[model samples]
Target: MEIEIATIGGYEEVGRQMTAVRAGDDIVVFDMGLNLSKVLIHDDVRTEQMHSLDLIDMGAIPDDRVMSDLQGDVKAIVPTHGHLDHIGAISKLAHRYDAPIVAAPFTIELVKDEIQDENKFNTENDLVTMEAGETMPIGDSGELDLEFVNVTHSIIDAINPVLHTPEGAVVYGLDKRMDHTPVIGDPIDMDRFREIGREGEGVLCYIEDCTNANKKGRTPSESVARDRLKDVMYSLEDYDGGIVATTFSSHIARVKSLVEFARDIGRKPILLGRSMEKYSGAASRMDGVDFPDVEMYGRRQGIERTFQRIMNEGKGNFLPVVTGHQGEPRAMLTRMGRAETPYELDEGDKVIFSATVIPEPTNEGQRYQSENLLGMQGARIYDDVHVSGHLSREGHYQMLQALQPQNVIPAHQNMKGFSGYVELAGNQGYKLGRDLHVTTNGNVIQLVEE
Candidate 1:
């Protein structure tokens, strides 16, 4: 049996992520995501209509490197979560493999929404939905076995992948934080992780998410954000003008918190922007998390109506949850900057950003422009009033010690983060590139019986 791993994208950099894992003759791909920086800022691949294939052909990201050698042997395409950086490239890239795509239910729902938004139907590939604790048998190859182990991340339905092989079991603990107090899902399945680590013979390698591999301390729970948001909303309630709160659309738990907060302070929750509607619709439709019979104006007209309502009913009567935490120009906040909405920012008005900067040049500039515009309108702006979803270095070390896998690999990191993983692996006495593999995008590493 042979094993290989490659970081097709999101290796040298942080987005347009694609990763391939091969065990013997069977192949699996995790996270065919778009490089948000490239698509939004650099290449300007605006709109959902932009096909990943077109981007691939244009050399936007390395496509062939991820697709090669898996024409018919592809068994599954799995995403760790619903984040666009993890699943955005799947419908566009994975459809060609003719394999079943598996993910947690919420992730699948979000991907479906994304596909429909782009007006492209991807019914060619089989879609299998599995919850956090379940294992589904995949592939005709005799030596391959796969399982999805639920874990905590920014968005819900995050999983750590396990591939069982004759040589041993390989765990992809990709893009996770050990948030026992995750707002939306069950706590980390530590018992299962320990059992898998103990039972697997070779357990040749463990590839983990290194998004926050360099940071120290455990990531705070989503509940912290909820409490802080509650306080901010209450404080803003003192103002009579429009109060707007923006966050990542996929942050269902955060949205839920906002809904509850609005209810607490006697304000209705009004969702704005196409993304807010899409994700909220998915959560209600699939996950059974319904927001109160709050008024929802869907899309273009919906946002305009929201602005009008704020003008008439007073912004203090409602909480407007919107997109554009990253200051993407087309998002609700940016459009507000352009004065497309009827409701204008006024003195004592509140604009709450419940997210952090993604650290891209365009994002920084857009955020600066948006903040300035809001400030000019005499709005009180709140920034970085949020916690991260990724596990920090100490969190990574804790999980590593908890699972105690035989080998360690760091994934979902750029070169600097990967170097940090190498240092940790060295401290653990794991040899780099052997037991501790630092894989690049599109490159594959195999596990062989020792």
Candidate 2:
């Protein structure tokens, strides 16, 4: 059997992540995602109504035209998680593929919502739900199989999909940290990973996320963030002013902590904003999720009414957990900053941001503008009460020791971001352009020629 890897999108930058692996006559696509920063850079751009080619030309979504060069049938389109960077382009480009979109339950539900909400393309790929620690056959070849290994990240129900081929296993490792004690889901399966490294022909190719490659030390666990959040909220128990909390809507674990701690501080917690409703609503309905039932409003009228009620009842009595941690223009917190909403920020009111600014110029500018607007209104900002979801240098060192793959690919980052990881891999004795591939989009690397 022959083996080949296509370095599609997400090779040069961190956002649009798409990779295809060909083992013999079967090909499996991993993460047909969108470069969300590309989309956000253009104001008033409604991507749901846009065409695939236009979005590709805008550098918003993956340019999968390179898929035509591969000589294999796509067996499955695997999205590792529900984050927009991983699954955002499913509705845009999935209609072009004949493969089924296979993912975990939460990711599948998110994909279904995206497809249903799409305005232009009618994407009708078969939705297959596979849980973590499960395996399914891929294509007619009995030698090929697909497995989902549980992994811990900011989002719930995240997994790393592994393609088992005749040569060896291809581990699609992205968007995870070495979290052994996540608040909501199971721990990162290091035992299974170590087992896989020693099993069969060993790992043939190990593709990894290098988002925090330049950062030193280990990425702290979600449990660590949870403790820090609890301490912060508990210390604010005596203050009687308005307290507004914000985080990633997709980060269900952090939201859960906010809700529980708000109640602990004797305040009613209300989940506001569109994405807060969408993500928390879907997550609470899923089985095995430890999310609590809380009041949420997504629609404009409903959110307005809720804010009015919060103001009427007294700001000290309610804790509003809204969106806009990164200060997206249309998000609830940004609207509040601009005073476009009814919720008023007083002189001593608190705004707790449980997220850090994404290391992009567009996000930094928007966040700065939003914070300035809030500061002008005399809102006391409590920022960066969060931890990253990607591995740092020590975590990368640990992964290489565990997997010990024959070939490695650094992904989910730009060339500058890949530099730290490149030096790290070199220290581990992997050479560039030989086994450790530093590649770009729309390129192909042949591992085993027929």
Candidate 3:
């Protein structure tokens, strides 16, 4: 049996996560994503005129040139979730291969939206939607079986795909945490993981998320973030000014909590921005969450109209949940801060950042500018009322104990992020570069039977 794994992107950095798994004659790709930090810096006019290769060269998308020789052998392009870092580059890259794109319904909808908006590729490619716990056969001969294991994360319908090859099974685990009390989805499928570990030659290799491995304990649940938001919002019930909150648009659970809280406090809940409309619509369509009474604004014109309505109806009577928690210049929160919206920020108005800065230089600068603009308007700022979605050190430890794979590979992070996984695996008796692999981008590791 011959199996090789290639780290195309997201090994040396935190974005553009793409991995290729070659089992014998068939090859499968997981996650064709983008590096948002690089993508956001490009001028819109220049990026629209640039080709995919140029974008790859500019570090906006994953560099998949290594798969040039094996393009015909590729069977599927699978995305784990709806986050831009996991599904953003699909419209630019999926047309190059003959394989179909397989993902959960929510992710598929987001990708379709991306394709419709970008029109980057004009090719006809098949899109296959697979829900959690379902298994599908890949390749013309059906030589490999791909299964999606349900997992809890910031985004709804996130999954860990397990590929069953002739040699053994390999699990691609990324962007998930074991949240037993998730607000929107079911708990992480730990029992299925144990079943995979104990059955059928067991797991050959486990490539896992290391983004939050440096943290000491388990990552907090989305429910915990709900409680935090409650604590912050409930304290301002009598404030006579506007209350605006910003968070990741893909976080359906957090959005649900915010909407519910706004209603509980007798404030009209309104969602602003195109992304908030897209993600919230997707979630409602998937039956992942219900927001029957919340109002939504999807365009700049609509947002401005809603802002004017809010100003007329008294700003204190409305709760606006917009995008730009990361201080994106085009997002609603930033536009509001720049005084481009109809509703003005009063001297004591509240601006709540429900998301954490991603710790990149670009994000830091953007957040600083946004905060400065808000401060100039005399708005009271509340930041970092959020919880991470990646697995921490203890979460990694629990996953290792449950899976108990023969070989371990740390993924979805740079060297600094991989360090915690290295230490945790070391404690479990997996030596470095032997049973445990700490690989970089463009490196390949082969697993063969003894």
Best candidate according to lDDT: 2
lDDT for residue 159 in candidate 2, whole number 0-100: 97
What's the lDDT for all of these models? 0.75, 0.91, 0.87
Looking at candidate 1, the ten consecutive residues that score lowest on lDDT are 58-67
Off by over 4 Å in 2: 288-293
> What tens digits encode model 1's per-residue C-alpha lDDT throughout 277-348?
877788888754777696665678767876886888776788888888887877888878667678777786
Give candidate 3 misplaced runs (Cα > 4 Å). Answer: 43-50, 69-72, 140-142
Candidate 2 structure quality by residue, lDDT tens digits, 1-450: 899999888988878899999999899999989887787777799989999999999898899999899999998999999999899999999998899999999999889988988999999899999999999999878889999999999999899999998788999999899998899989999999999998999999999999999999999999999999998899999999899999999999999999999999999999998889888888877764555568999998999999999999999999999988888888899999999988999898899999998887788898999899999988999889999999999999998999999999999988999999999999999999899999999998888788
Model 3's number of clashes is 0
Clashes found in each candidate (C-alpha, N, C closer than 3 A)? 15, 0, 0
Tens digits of per-residue lDDT for model 3, 338-405: 99889899898999998999867788888999999998988999988999989889988888888888
* lDDT head-to-head 1 vs 3, winner: 3
- Residue 230 of model 2: what lDDT? 94
* Winner of 2 and 3 under lDDT: 2
lDDT at residue 119 of model 1 (Cα atoms): 50
Question: In model 3, which range of ten residues has the least summed lDDT?
Answer: 41-50
The top-ranked prediction according to TM-score is: 2
